[model samples]
Target: MSFLTFGVGPSKLSAETAQDLRNAADLQIAEISHRSQAFAEISRRALGGLRTFLRIPDSYHILYTSSASEAMELTIQSTVELASFHFAQGKWSQYFADIAKHFRRRVLIDTVEWGQKNDFRNTFVPTEADLITICHSETSTGVACDLADIRAVRHRFPSTFLAVDGTSIMGAVAVDIALADIWLFSVQKCFGLPAGLGVMIVHERVFERAADLIARGVHNPGVFNLPAMFTMVQKDCNTVATPNVLGIYLLAQQMERWNAQCTMESRERETREKAELLGRAIEKSSSFRFLVRAPEDRSPTVCCVRSDPQTITSLHALCRAQGIELGKGYGKLKEETVRIANFPAITCGDIQRLLQVLEHVRSRTPAA
Candidate 1:
């Protein structure tokens, strides 16, 4: 029997994506050399598809990594010299801040409550900070910071390198890519693909910053650093190491499918509609309410709900027993909330089925 899980990732794959994987294996795509011309064509096609699908500007350089966590590490190591500032709301944003601190860089973090949004208007970054980081969509709490907020930060701090973690909402939402110096995401979340590939769209300013750091001898460009990655991309559409060939192939195929069927604008509208439907259904039920209070702040890709510990647990079990799986909450809210994914791969019918199960469960449970 087939099952649907609303977990953040690794999300359910579409039939076409799965079939493409089988086709790749039949052709031995993964066994081919990264230096081979076949791989070059794959790389070129994938990059071209992403550029068209996302409207990535010609000024930005795209690079691939193992995961978004590695993207965070590489960005921090390569660009940040002395300090970094973070507008943190959830676990992922806080983790990025911790990664900066682990590099021995001074980190100044302005944090908000777990379920609340980050107030960037009152927040200030120190002049000493060379980099500023924000999670565009905080998967842990299902709160997405507005692109306008990012643009405002860029206007206030023109010289600082801005990095955004668009992990869970990249492909599903319409983001203003030009607003940030670096935007990164993993395909596992919104692209409905297997994990292990992270995409980073970097502005030329980041490259210049890395070069300046190298010139001053303040930071060594590691073998896997951004400059080195850029060099590899320029040379052969490859990486410093043997890349995930299958992942690249799958992403390229999925991107083309998205482009042909639903443009990003239409996808964003459908996603918002589905999220509103789910949010309203949950609000009407006594067992669950949205974790994010402000409707505008809630994520279109990931929906998180709050309820009592026992009720949340019971709901999870009920869904599982019915061949449906729901995501458990993350961090401190683990016992108090249930997380649901609203990715492009999950259809409206899937959500309707989930609502039916939720209603059935709610009718039997006592009001909290």
Candidate 2:
């Protein structure tokens, strides 16, 4: 739904709040030159806020790109010399593998069904694999890869690099930033901001790997290579290309707001409460059943619910006509399930209204 894509303004559930656009207007962030000292200050504040909010370690460096997919392309092209193994938890994680394949890297994946976890066991990982990728939150299926499982993979495959995608839950969840050598995400979903900014938090080892690839004369250092991006990042937090200046400013503002008002722990507690509320509501509904049946498999941010195709269609139209919006299911579940984004931008009042609408619709329609 449009609301899932910045349709709901300041009330977002996570690091976003009201008066953001007004504050931007007051500061005139839009008019500043990218290389100017003013933009540099903005960039520093934004990076600083991200470090504070995400607890990024000193061992890692953050890079900016046009989008998260670009981050995948850069990482894949630069570090992967021989092969890359993927935990294809859902469509997005699979997309990471797809990028590596596009670069001609031998790709191997342990594909898992929707609503299930990936096998972090050593049996699935290859010794020759240069990098291992996993999606911490699978937005499509509403399932998550356990951080413990990831850490176990790390211990077993100590030499291979690890990459984790946090696209759908970065701002809303507390991630152990050290769990992977590379962590990437886009701003739209959890950060509750408009799209076009992609962030990659990379471990120093990733740079070493990229450098090794370069020395071997086999590296594909796309226009925005790791070393080059690192150089620009050191240039007072500047980016390689003309950056997403507005997105960075708004993110810094939102990060500062979140830092002042909400601890990540508290934000997670709020997320759990909201999830529980939605879970109960879904359990009680006659026409709507959770697509992911297990409680542990459900995402803290994206909730997927299943119903008949007709009910799903009716619900979409009903929610649409009332100015309420919900996320649509992806892949094979598209027509049979509806997604409820549990982003903080969506308030409890919004949830109640959505539930009321859902209940109202269900009362009149028979379940399959």
Which candidate wins on TM-score? 1
Per-residue lDDT tens digits for candidate 1, residues 107-197, read 9999999878888766878999988998988999999888888888989998888999999999998888888899999999989999999
Q: Lowest summed-lDDT stretch of 10 residues in model 2?
A: 2-11
Error of 1 at 190 (Å): 0.5
Task: State each candidate's clash count.
Answer: 0, 6
Q: List the residue pairs that clash in candidate 2.
A: 11-345, 12-344, 12-345, 13-344, 13-345, 14-344
Candidate of highest lDDT: 1
Candidate 2 residue spans exceeding 4 A from truth: 1-18, 363-368
**What are the Cα lDDT values of the candidates?**
0.88, 0.81
Deviation from native of the Cα of residue 154 in model 2, angstroms: 1.6
Per-residue lDDT for 245-338 in model 2, tens only? 9889988887888889887788888888887888898888888877777788788888888888888899888888877767778889999887
For model 2, what is the alpha-carbon lDDT of residue 175? 83
